[model samples]
Target: MATGRAKGRGRGRARGRDETQDERADRMWSELIQEVRVAQTGVQILFGFLLTVVFTARYPQLSQTDRTIYIVTVVLGASATGALIGPVSFHRLVSGRRIKPQAVTWASRLTLAGLLLLLATMTSALLLILRVATHGDYTPWVVVGVVAWYLLCWFVLPLWVRLRHTTID
Candidate 1:
């Protein structure tokens, strides 16, 4: 009878792990914090560099179109920074609320949003830089190729692995 109750509780839970929901949430939260730390550092640095670009001697020499791209890139970087940092703030406000599982879910969503924003920010920054460095027809082509690489490495490969290796049990 005790074995039956244990089996019942384990149903619909992750396979190959004998952890309670709260234990799983704690593990996930730790992993998420590590991941967020890496992304946050990168976006913060990128955003800082973007902030300084306007003060550079080359700023006034930029074409109107290039300036527009720069503005867009800066805004994207700022947004990505915000999104990446949001999970920490969210966790702080909701800590000790007996909602670790919910908090983890929300944090995961924010991290994903942050990653997407970072991708957009990087794409715009690359495009603007290439345009400024070389006024040639190959600029867009180069940007497209780099963006494709990012998409493959950041999104496609991980998703493919998940789909190919994940089991239904």
Candidate 2:
């Protein structure tokens, strides 16, 4: 009798789990959707709040530089929202095409792009807020530290675990 890892076409691959291409794709798609949902909610709320900032009475009093930062931050937030939501539209349009594996790959790429955009949006927003509130030289330094923290939390630790815990299947 064959072992569990040898029972599927994915044997000898990455994690060496027993799953066919379709099964793997299905599982990945489900996981991706859950991740996207969380990101989408955050981006949507941030973008909505960003949209309201311009209407506030204090907006017109902001310096030219502050206004520019605000504009850039809003644009980044909008772009993040679009990319994060792209997978849903992509899946809906391509469903029943029997190309789920390919669809999942594209969706994952979109999700990654969305995450990077979200990171940019968040950092930009933070910078703008800090500059407005502090108007001090330390604001940029503080923003840099926060960005590093985000990178560590979002990418570095996960990558470290993936590198350290997994075997070379």
Candidate 3:
């Protein structure tokens, strides 16, 4: 009495989601867009704030090193914002092309790239801030520690879950 049909019963599907390839793509695209929206809001806000730093009175008082760090951080933030927003443009251009699956793949890649850029921007911003907040020698150590934490949370845990618990199709 073995019904080999994995249809409708949600069997033999990866992670028990039980969906067709197109269905999976659609679900994933929706999920990816939602995630992008959250990240986009954060990065856009951070980038906007970064853009305003040059107008602050304290900007001219910053050391040359700090200025360089600020510039790099701004560039990273802008890049992250672009990458995070790239998916929308990609989706718009490909909407009627009958390539939802391909579009989803590309969008996911862009989101990952955006996340990486955001990490770099955050690390640079932290370094600059800590350097200004405390002139002590421990500033670098604090930045490194914070970067490690971000890495753990942003990259390591998700990768571990994907590798450890995911089933291959």
Candidate 4:
């Protein structure tokens, strides 16, 4: 005997409370997937470019230390790519096990690890490029400056805003 608008309001009220853990996990998983999609594309592209660098003619001219750095950077890039892509594979393998909460938590960890690895890969790549392009003693300083800038932009600013605006419950 309920009207349509009353029934709609009832449904909305049902959804307004704090979500259960399972519901929260499902929502988190969807958000994580979307974030991973964005990161995976960029990491894959960067890794692909890193793989191609060794085959270029200019590679042989690099100093032994530079070669070593390049190798480490490529390995880091590969590792980052794998970590970033892991959540999709993980979700596919365990989609129906009713373990969405655990899956989401693990995927979040993997994504964080991937981001750290990506940061390292980018720093090393920048160092290599700067060294190759300008062979100057100032390269290390410049690299440090840029790394600090990246840290400030990526981590510090976000944390500062969160701390400034968010209230502790």
Candidate 5:
């Protein structure tokens, strides 16, 4: 008769019947996929919209500086869309390779990069739009203020709350 503790069989050093590593990995993967799905849709739409802007009549009317900004924004958006969609490609290539942990790590990094790129794209887009719409001296200041607000809301607050509430064990 084999005991539950047969070497490498039963849960070991686990708090309250710890889940198998595979199970934990599977759960994390599913959560990551869900998050990626949401981000992918948003970036795809934004990138599509950006692609069409160049064909618009107003595009040629933009000042040289605004045109440069528009170009930067479009490139940033394209990069972001690629990064956000990278996980799917990664998963497809590595499926059944017993490398879920590594795949998850890489995917998470890509997602973060995508987010940062998206931030840059949005900021540049806003700056260009505001410059065209307002034509005032304060456009740059307004763009900076809005960018700062986005940084605070998207990154700072979440990090602060996480630091305040989470405990390292």
Candidate 6:
């Protein structure tokens, strides 16, 4: 079995896990969809809450800068929501065209972009809330710390794992 694996690797193997190209694409598509589902649910909930904030009685008391931040946060949330849901629409449109490999690539890109947008939205939301809650200069530092944590969990750690563990081939 080890020798057979070595021979397969030496021949520029097509797919890992013994899957054919189409099967690989299907598996990848499924995994990407699952990831999107988790992200989409969160963003959608956040966006829904954001949309309702403007009508809240407390919204009128926010400072001009806070209002600006709120607007930016809402926009970022909307963008993130769109990006996170884009993969589903992309897949649906391209389903019968037999171009899943390309679709998967596009979906993956969209998912990454969505996650970045989500990070921005969450950071902005946190900053606005902290500013309103604390009414102090320390809010920025606190927000920075939280954002760093998010970056570590969402990006840095994943990248480290990818680089540290993945085969160079």
Off by over 4 Å in 6: 1-15
lDDT of 4 by residue, 2-90 (tens): 75435535543432336699988988999999988988898899889989999999999999999999999999999999999999999
Q: Residue by residue across 1-169, what tens digits does model 6's lDDT show? A: 5653355565564324766789889999999999999999999999999999899999999999999999999999999999999999999899999899999999999999999999999999999999999998999999999999999999999999999877754
Off by over 4 Å in 3: 1-15
Please tell me which predicted candidate would have the highest lDDT against the true structure.
1
Displacement of residue 40 (Cα, Å) in model 2 is 0.4
In model 2, what are the clashing residue pairs, if there are any?
A: none
TM-score for candidate 2, residues paired by index: 0.91
Residue lDDT tens for model 3, 1-169: 5343444455544336657888888899999999999999999999999999999999999999999999999999999999999999999999988789999999999999999999999999989888888888999899889999999999999999999987665
Clashing pairs in 5: none
> How far is each candidate from the true structure, as Cα RMSD in Å?
3.9, 3.3, 2.6, 5.0, 5.5, 3.5
Q: Which TM-score value belongs to model 3?
A: 0.89
Candidate 6, overall lDDT? 0.93
Give the TM-score of each candidate.
0.91, 0.91, 0.89, 0.85, 0.86, 0.91
Candidate 4 vs. true structure, TM-score: 0.85
List the global CA lDDT of all models. 0.94, 0.93, 0.92, 0.89, 0.86, 0.93
Residue-pair clashes per candidate: 0, 0, 0, 0, 0, 0
Candidate 1, backbone clash total: 0
lDDT of 1 by residue, 1-169 (tens): 5553366455575345667999999999999999999999999999999999999999999999999999999999999999999999999999999999999999999999999999999999999999999998999999999999999999999999999979886
- If both were scored by TM-score, which would come out higher, candidate 2 or candidate 3? 2
User: Which run of 10 residues does model 2 get worst, by summed lDDT?
Assistant: 6-15
